[model samples]
Target chain A: MTVHALKRFDNVTELAPQALVPADTSRGLSITAQGLEKSFGDNRVLRGLDFHVPAGQFVAIVGRSGCGKSTLLRLLLNLDQASGGQFWFGERNDAKPDKSAVRVMFQEPRLLPWASVLSNVEVGLGDKRGTPEGRALALDALRNVGLETRRDDWPAVLSGGQKQRVALARALVSNPRVLAFDEPLGALDALTRISMQKLLGQVWVDQGFTAIMVTHDVAEAVTLADRVLIIEEGEIAMDLSVDLPRPRERGSVEVAQLEGRILRELFRNSKAGEDA
Target chain B: MSAPAEKFSNLTQWILPIGILVVWQVLSSIGFIPGRVLPAPTDVILAGWKVLLNGELAKNIWVSFWRALVGFAIGGGIGFALGLANGLSRRSERFLDSTLQMIRNVPHLALIPLVILWFGIDETAKIFLVALGVFFPIYINTQHGIRTVDAQLVEMGQTYGMTRGALFWRVYLPGALPSIFVGLRYALGIMWLTLIVAETIAASSGIGYMAMQAREFLLVDIVVLSILIYALLGKLADSTARLLERLCLGWHPAFQKR
Candidate 1:
């Protein structure tokens, strides 16, 4: 069943460039993982998993808490090493992780309270980038997030949504090939979440980085991701594609149907767990 | 109206001190309190004026000020370096923290007798005492601050591809600074206390030495003046530290009101 789902996903990726809107294919790195396993002592978080994300694709992984979705995200970002299996970025599959090619926005903004919003974004550009050029790039990112006016403000002064926008800017300032988000908008209010969803979709389209997001909000997954993956028991139980057009309506029938299917899969597992 | 309200508040601040001064002056004039036990405020002021005119007050104050400043710098520098070393590396902490913790328990004042015996009532003994007294607060607080820095922010820095040194400068050091300032304010208090004790025990100069010399001759007024000088100096040091905290940690929530 998993292989069948993966084959369908491959078909979608092959059809994506021609069938749907043509995404910017020049800037993203393809991700490939085979039999990726992670264990903490006796407790195995991720049993074994295989997945692939094409360059410039926006994919969302949704699952119940403790299904190792976050653990998988961490492994992808090289924050934790896999116990076994091969993960590749582009063509390189060596043990040495390519940290500079990827950046992440956590559930919280994680902005250094001591730094101004501009300086926080500048941190994304490591020392190799010259100071003046880095500052210009950081400012450009802030402008993209529509927070150029707040460049001098401290993170403490920002609203929850604004802080997340700063986090987004910081993630994008370095022009990373892959952007990983671990529930980046989970803390915002409903209205703010909608607006941020629009902003994230727009930015991902503009920058065209291979975007992977792990979230529990099924509706969010359906609305934003071009591909929705439902992970169950450390495995991809469902790999479905959202073929809807960009700027999707929130309460549209197509979006609601996809959300319902994803939620049913998530709840079915939780119900089974309770019965056990 | 707001200006008057502000003026009223300022007046309220001074009311108690002025009232105490009046009571002291009246008691001294009426002979209700003996002057020998505690000299009158006027007598202290007059003694202070005399010392000031003769340059004794300036010289002694300068000596004590320089001693505290130099001692604090040495002790604070060492404490900050050690804190960074142990905070960043588990190996350094394992090798050094236990021995330092054991030594921290010993009250620095208890070493005065040995210090004097070793250095014999010289500048070395006095400065050593002050440095030893100031060291522990900064060291312990700095280590505590570094350890307590938010782990999520550190992880964020790592994911951004910061080198270890860059992470320390950009994240760990800034995160620990507020706590370091707290240590600094506490250490300033100890700096003055240790200097007073050290100068009293064995010194030819400084405010404590002058006060001791006045006591030998029963010059109660000069002794009272010296006490007032110590109080003023302590207040000055505390205010200076608070000003620095305001300047450096303006982003801190507590300091943001200004």
Candidate 2:
């Protein structure tokens, strides 16, 4: 029975792409948030927040703590319902949340520690097939992240960097329409963080999925994202498109200028909020 | 530095037990105690062999083993049912938890006389006593296991849109397995202990009966041999439980890393 499951799982590569966008559906990417008011009791977190992502866009959200950057991501994922706003997926009507096309990578690796690297990746496949076929697809996903050799190894045995790689493999396995990264590399050390930043950019370029990342780091926003969206007080304060070349350097003049601008906007917002 | 050294290092853990056994055998041989009151190690071995040759010891061992196994099965089944139901369902927990806790406070050994009166000196009373003794530990541990599953893992399952049944099977059961195994091992140990006590009090034929019969006849060697058999059997049950824990929780973080 497990061998049959393995065969079925291996067939994911053969299965027709379920995410084939309709040719006539000109509306490729749209995220509508209107009257998006959220509150934990009396302290309102997000107030009338709104944003949109065009087709195949790389958007990075940068903000200080308690500016509701995380909350905004939660709203976007539909993990938590908005108090008043209607959130849509790919220009779909707000009738219901179609989370089938969305994949989220949390800040924590959140890899099932008991599972092998291959099986963990297969979790993204859902009930698309049985275990073995899912496992084969999982192996393929691991290959994409250069972790094929460690397929049979348990999550506990993997290093932090390797675990995050496994997490990336898991997120990408199902081929979701939008890959939502919730500060996915925030926990890594400085050296590993930069390396992962490069990996993220490469994966984003290869996969060509609409990516939305939430990060506190301005350089990260400037380095990887096509457009940097600075959110302050549950509002988009700055949404600037990065006109820099591929493999943008952190110490480069243009990237530094952009990072400074974003940081200034964040500081100004924080001071104003405090005074209010 | 060499193969012998490596072998010795690997076998070092058994040194204390071996030493204790050797000391015990020497003390018995050197007339450290009277033979009638405390039979020599060799006399105990001779008595064990004599009973084995006569088939008396084997019959008694089998009888006790079967009783304990059956009683363990019944009590473990009921305990698991109650534990899972109460652990998962708030309404069930509210209704059953207080009552089970109240019952758990009553000692199983204390209930032996009442049990004998209620069910008579037949196998039913002995099995009942064993089952009653084994029940609480398994129930408490199983409940603890279910309660201790990571809420984050459950949320992840929910986000994946798993059905309630699927959630129970995949997330809840596997997550609770380590704790449940702990309870299982504890209950298994209790099963043997309770069986011995029950058999000594009322059994017609068993290791306990042999020990009691030998005591009456003043056959110190047979009594000592019977005690050895009991100890060996208890060790076997414990080792089996440990092996099962290793098998079942092979994937757990603590076990996997080790």
Candidate 3:
């Protein structure tokens, strides 16, 4: 379950030089973390961890429940302060993480039930600051997600997949440099989930925003991520790069092999815990 | 759920009330129930017609309507403001909620004598009484609503960099509205009850006063007519609140018929 074991894969890709350059000159903030640690009282959730996500790179973090994968995402999101660490955004070594530059789509759509579909997307722009121009942007974002037809519908009326699509639209409407997905597709049906994964991949590729997805679904990570980080305990267990090209086929030999490897890593840690 | 079954169910709803009215009317017409005890439907309608012709009923209805409206505005407005203050701020809740809770416990009716002493039998006393009665439900419901807004949604709002005012308007207020409407509906019922009790106890004009005046003369028809008027007014208030709830909370799952 070490980085050395992950190096066995022949298809493992190295960071491309172009990815290091910001994809969108006006947006796309790169992330760097050094000895990141988070604790609630004495129980440390994320013990000292280091990683770098190049601008616009799609990285997925996979782990068993309570392995601090989500905590790491939250720290990167600045939703919670890290107990100890140096986390910076962009190329600058001292750039403080900006809230406006980062947006997160949660396990639930989290659309305001009181707002219309269009208004819900407009919420991504942050409150009353959403002018007519913002509304047009929101509409365009919905169009990107293929939910423009449901612009006036209530969230309650939307199906689970549709709700997640709306949430995706909301997340992208602000044109955030970084988009964090906290198991956003975990709740969808099998068919719906696959379609959504494709939609998400297409959107991410087109927008060229840095994506950090945390998921229990190892296969999903392999299918969508440019690189997959398997977290064991509070640290990164395996940081395997997926050299596979875009529009990855489901149940392909390579994807299945990567999925098996990640699952094995995940199960080994749990088995070790049980032994303890 | 089918169309024919839905039609049947709708029809069945009116059957019981119509049946009761028929039985009551038959019994009263036969004189089995004395007119002195309870007037028949015909007698009540006749008395209502008499009042209508003289414009007495319109005058009394106007007087009562204004009192309820003015009192509700004062009480409901204060309740809503205080609810928001306490709901949104821990400091305000700690300072004000206990005092309000203590005041809420004393039956608003019990303060009628004190209110009369302070404001006399003028419109002020009745309005004050109604205001007192209507405040508690609105305040309590508003607080509960705001406190129970989905934590996840609030966190989402914060992550989106919404300002305090924006969060309150976009998240807190809409989340609290359904509960606030529940309080308003409850307050409307209490508003009428308080006005009825106040008018009956001491008042120069209103439906309650007309009923009281009728009772002394043993005019059962007029008394019955007044009670019906009170029922109609209560229904009117409730329907108005419900309509407002429908308009404001169209996005609410419960209100989404389809």
- TM-score of the second chain for every model: 0.93, 0.94, 0.95
Residue-level error in angstroms, candidate 2, position B92: 2.8
Show the lowest summed lDDT stretch of 10 residues, model 3 chain A. Answer: A1-10
Order by DockQ, highest first: 3, 1, 2
lDDT of 2 by residue, B130-190 (tens): 8888889889988888888887667666665567897798788888888888888889889
Model 3's number of clashes is: 0
Q: Using TM-score as the measure, name the better of candidate 2 and candidate 3.
A: 3
Model 1: lDDT of residue B106: 95
Off by over 4 Å in 1: A1-22, A92-99, A128-130, A272-276, B1-19
Model 1: per-residue Cα lDDT over A55-145, one tens digit each: 8888999988888999999998878999999788775676453566688999999999999999998888876345787888888778777
Q: Give the winner by TM-score.
A: 1
Candidate 1 lDDT score at position B109: 90
Per-residue accuracy of model 3 over B128-206 as CA lDDT, tens digit each: 9888888999899999999999999999998888889889999999999999999999999999999999999989999
lDDT of 2 by residue, A1-276 (tens): 111112122232233333222222222245566678778788788887767787567889988888888988887776788887766766666455344467788888777666678877877777754667676777777776667889988888888878888888877776666778889888998877877776676556555667889998889989988898887777778889997976577789999998988877777745555633
Off by over 4 Å in 2: A1-29, A94-99, A131-133, A269-276, B1-10, B256-258
lDDT string, candidate 3, A107-172, tens digits: 999999999999998888764346887777787777766678889999999999889988987887
Residue pairs clashing, model 3: none
Better of 2 and 3 by DockQ: 3
Cα distance off (Å), candidate 1, residue A5: 35
